[model samples]
Target: MKTKFLLDPNITFLNHGSFGAVPREVFAVYQQWQRTLENQPVRLLGRKLPSELRAVKSALGSVLNANPENLLLISNVTFGLNLAARSLNLQSGDEILTTTHEYGACLNTLKYLAHKSGARLVQQPVSMPLKSPEDVIEEIWSGVSPKTRLLFLSHITSPTASRFPVAQLCRRANRAGILSIIDGAHAPGQLEIDLAEINADIYMGNCHKWMLSPRGAGFLYAGSAVQAILEPLVVSWGWNVDTPATPEMGLLENLQWTGTYDPSAFLSIPAAIDFQRKHNWINVHMSAQETLSRFLHRFSESFNIPIAYTPEADPYIQMAVLLLPPIKDPEKFQNQLWCKYAIEIPCIEWQEHQFLRVSYQVYNTEADLDRLFSAIEDLMPSFLTTSSHTKSGSL
Candidate 1:
């Protein structure tokens, strides 16, 4: 099938785990919303915007299995995490436990919060060559203590692309009386997400990443119990203390409308959902996952790379990270792949070994994987022989 959204045909785009490419149809809908807003800015923003956003949230909620009241549309997962971080009631000696394999931006957010609240951010280490979901949950929970107040985790990690057993961990957190915050940035489109089933106290996901919406589209799902505890990062008209607003009003006023900004991205959520349905995304995802597994198996064997996780244990979608040989200059080697071969994939340095993460979408094919394989085959020998060659080619 031909790709309907992405126009970048020249480059072998395997970086859907990063900022996702939007589908043309959904993007058209986004633009239409933008134009409508521009045509009647006053009516759109002041009168129709709230109702429009509520409908969008309802549509998204039905798919996510979330309460429409609890979910607020945000720009990105980072923004949602930032709101949570700022709202957390951390104190000295309170520990925020997390895995070592989290996204760097989320890690930084946790660090900033820790510094501000005098709370310790404890990073639990999970060794590679993951066997099962239970093993992951065990390794992560072993780090939690009586002082652990919060459990932060990624549903699907950015660097490693391994799917964590967040649902089970969230249950463990509940028993321990620790708050759970899950970064589900890559999980929404890649997996069948039932937020109620997962039951994290706070969960955030990006529609922009894998959901194929426009940039500046994401959601924060806070459980009804924890809604009152969260303070909005931006204090707008929503924080009117004199008005004695309802709980719903508090959420809309404080979090939903965060000053003046384009709501086109949020308004386009239904279109993104509809696009997936029209394309039969479930079948597409399963097919893509199988293709990715085969490619990973072949690529890893050819390059003498190690597999980070077993296929059966963490097979949620089309993202996988292969462990490569330890490179002296990973940054340089990463750049060489892009500069020489027009390959777009993430090369990460994690715990000494370098990792090459390949994210497959509907647009990717075996031909794309072949180009990446060819590029690696050509570059690996040169990188091992001459270190300086890499530096010269890299940006």
Candidate 2:
């Protein structure tokens, strides 16, 4: 599986939750689309691009269990969320409620929108040793008020790598008449996504992360009810409500043609999906989960570091956040791990605690976890002992 990917073989990569590695075959398809567009730019852009986007949408919709007409292909999750944030009609004194576990970019987008609209952006706090879905629901729902016009949350958190119960949360918001906008950036490939079942008002995901598509591939999905409120982030030919050039152009078409850029990554999404399907991704996912669980147990026992969550209760399928012994400088520890050992992984600082997030993909193996363990074991003593003054001086 590792051999099929374009990732550098020399480096141990445990950060698939970040920018994903593209398979060789998928990259070939992506490049071929680019070449085809280059060969006949006018025809492809003018005659074929619309149909191509529609086909891609249908393919994605089938997998996502969403309506093709309601989906818009965007560059990444942040881009999609930006479109959503701008489209939302937030007003003075309204609150857009979210949790602290959200991705920073999305959080900033919300903050910017809140500032622009005079709406308050509230960050609901969630604690570690995370409890059940019901508990999380109650804690998060406590933040919701009559002023909460929007509910934004991550399906799988980036900082702590905890999977929130978005479906239940969405239901709560829907009952309260609050619009639900879920950031599923890490969920498309990491978990089973049946948007039909989840029923959020608006949802967005990144295909470039766990989905294994080329970079800059993501989609924004809006429910039929919310279509009218969606305004285009960039005004273009497809949508000019004042002029009304083509009244037929709906939300999907209006947002799809947001100027000319490389749509090759978007086109190759089906190839990435097909690659996962052919390989029996569920088994691969289970294998990786089991491997991760084993590694977490051993690492926890070896270092006497407490595990954040029980294995049975943890919802982080392939990615687990391992709490580390208190380190003086997390940034230095992360840099040293990558620079000294070529072990590429996420060392996160959340809630004033240090954690190492390990991501397991189809391309990863038990050997990769062993390498990480060995590297950290060798570096932990020095990392803990190194004086903050020394680190500050070096910096």
* Model 1, runs deviating above 4 Å: 248-253, 385-395
What TM-score against the true fold does each predicted structure earn? Answer: 0.95, 0.95
Name the runs in model 2 displaced over 4 angstroms. Answer: 243-248, 385-395
Clash tally, candidates in order: 1, 0
What's the distance in Å from true for residue 195, model 1?
Answer: 0.5
| TM-score of candidate 2 on Cα atoms, chains taken together | 0.95
What root-mean-square deviation over C-alphas does model 2 reach?
3.7
Q: Model 2, residue 255: displacement in angstroms?
A: 1.1
For candidate 1, which ten residues in a row score worst on lDDT?
Answer: 386-395
lDDT of 2 at 204: 95
